[model samples]
Target: MNNEVIVTCAVTGAGDTVGRHPAIPVTPQQIAAAAVEAAKAGATVVHCHVRDPASGKPSRDPELYYELVDRIRASGVDMILNLTAGMGGDLEIGPGEEPMRFGPGTDLVGGLTRLIHIEQLLPEICTLDCGTLNFGDGDQIYVSTPNQLRAGAKRIQELGVKAELEVFDTGHLWFAKQMVKEGLLGEMPLFQLCLGIPWGAPADTGTMKAMVDNMPPGAIWAGFGIGRMQMPMVAQAVLLGGNVRVGLEDNLWLDKGVYASNGSLVERAVDLVAKLGANTLTPEQGRKKLGLIKRR
Candidate 1:
């Protein structure tokens, strides 16, 4: 447990959060701006997801990804860019009456197509969701089979970009260990313990500890919880010898009736980490710690 913890802010996720939160960044400009703000407020890393400019729905558009990454780089914030390669896997089953026919909201794609943006941009780090699960409030299934994950990991390795392993459940963690054993991971693997997602690991001390205990040896890991559990998990993660992540992607409100800005969420996490007698890592320090070589 190092005293210095790297803080990552997942600024805006690619969920249906536009109408729900007035501050959910939509366009490339908005997303980049939010990322810059998060970096300035003490986030060493920024996890990103793009959305359609007009409809505000999640998009796999390479153009959008390019614009967003370009803007963040141009902003001069210098945060580690972590693009999401977790899209194009949404499956909303159709009526049982039409078994073979796919239903609405089924946007599944092959591995290469899903990670088209990562192939082009080659950010310092990109996400590789380790496993699939029943996702969200709907009956949607987020499919990430072993073969799909292997292909994605191979592509990420080909680009020489670090993969941020996102583990949503215990089974996901087990599969991640398998990847490590198979040598799919790099010298210093990076992981993110995503707690409190629907039908996944619950956001509690016991569950968090269990997940942390299961982390493969020598892996750099961070933990975050959703909604009201955001700040609490920040403290828990730090005390339990892991890094912390925060932002509107996992939480909408900063307090009882207060909607939070990305910067505010980051500031709160920084304060908590510092108060716990742990220092926070800068983007450069974080990159070094995570074994990510800066893209010239």
Candidate 2:
């Protein structure tokens, strides 16, 4: 078990969870506030994703991202910012034979186009989804081809931003290692093992262990499970010699029926880490461990 675990709080995600949870941050101000709260509650890193204030839907607006980042920085909090570069890849297909006729949810774009916000904000870390997957049981799909991932990984390296390779399945992890082998990623690579998402990797101890064992050597990695498996995965990740991630992004409930804020989630994670005889790393220590060069 790692003695120093980096706890990352994914503040707000780009899911349809605004109405589901009362405290799900919608506006830029709200998102930034959540980030600050999480930092204060002992999160070393904050993973952010902006939403359209008017409709409470996921947005790719760089202006909103700028505002969110500015607010977080101005708050005097020293949390590592990790923005999502996984947007603009949604492809909603039509009924049966009419797959060519895309649905309204489709927001597909090129690889670089998805990184516009990352390019503008220049956060300490940004995520690079390693591969595509059938998002859910619906007609929608998350499209991130191998070529797109290669391009995105290379660009993130060029930008001097740490790219957290998001591996949803074993195949994704394999390709992520391939990117490292091709020298597309930086010398010190970062990875996030995303588990329990619909139609993706199942949330189980064996699966998490398998993924953790297959990770590239010397890579800084974090693992998280969605919904009810969130806290369990926390212990699992730490036990497997990896970091931990928590917050409303992956799981909304603090308990059986209780909704959770990002801060509460981080607080719980901090306690869990301590109880396991491991301490959560501070922001500076996390930066050092992950080889992150904070921007501004």
Candidate 3:
């Protein structure tokens, strides 16, 4: 088990979770506030995804991201910022024989287009989903071809922003290492093992351990699971010699029937890590550990 851990709170995801919880941070202001709350509760990093203020739907507008990051910085809260570059890859296929007609949920775009916010905002870290998957129990799929991933990884490296390679399955992990081998990624790569998301890797002890065992040497990695497996994975990740992630983006409840705020989830994670004889690292410590140079 790691003696020190970095706790990352994914403030708001692009999932359809709004209105399902009392506080899901819809607008930029709300999202920023959630990040600050998580930081105060002992989160070393905040993973953010902006949403439409009016409709509470996921958005990829750079303006919204700018405002969110700006608000967090202006608050004077010390936390490593991690932006999601996984948007703009949603492909919602049409039902039945009209497969050519994409559904309204589709927001597919080129690889670089997805990084517009990252290029402009230049957060300390941004995620690069290593591969695609059948995202959910629908016609929707998250598309990230190998070539597109190569281009995105290269651009992120050029921008001097740390790329958090998000691996959802063993194949994704394999391709991520390939990118490193191809020199598309920089030294000391960061990875996030995503589990229990619909049709991705299931949140099982063996599955997480297998992924952890396959990570490249000298890499900084974190792991998280969705829904009820969130807290369990925190312990699993820490005991398996990696960092941990927890937030409303992955799970909504603090207990069986209780809804959780971003801060509360982080607070619980801090306690869990402490119970396991590991202390949560500060943002500065996390930066040093991950080899990240703070920007702005």
lDDT of 1 by residue, 136-168 (tens): 765678989999998888888888999999999
**lDDT: which candidate is best?**
3
Model 3 lDDT-worst window of ten = 212-221
lDDT of each: 0.90, 0.93, 0.95
What TM-score would each prediction reach against the true structure? 0.97, 0.99, 0.99
Across 117-236, the per-residue lDDT of candidate 3 in tens digits comes to: 999999999999999999989999999999999999999999999999999989999999999999998999999999998789999899999998898888889999999999999999
Of candidates 2 and 1, the better by lDDT? 2
How much is the lDDT of residue 286 in candidate 3? 94
Error of 2 at 105 (Å): 0.9
The total number of steric clashes, by the backbone 3 Å criterion, in model 1 comes to 0
List the candidates ranked by lDDT, beginning with the highest. Answer: 3, 2, 1
Q: How would the candidate models be sorted by TM-score, starting from the highest?
A: 3, 2, 1
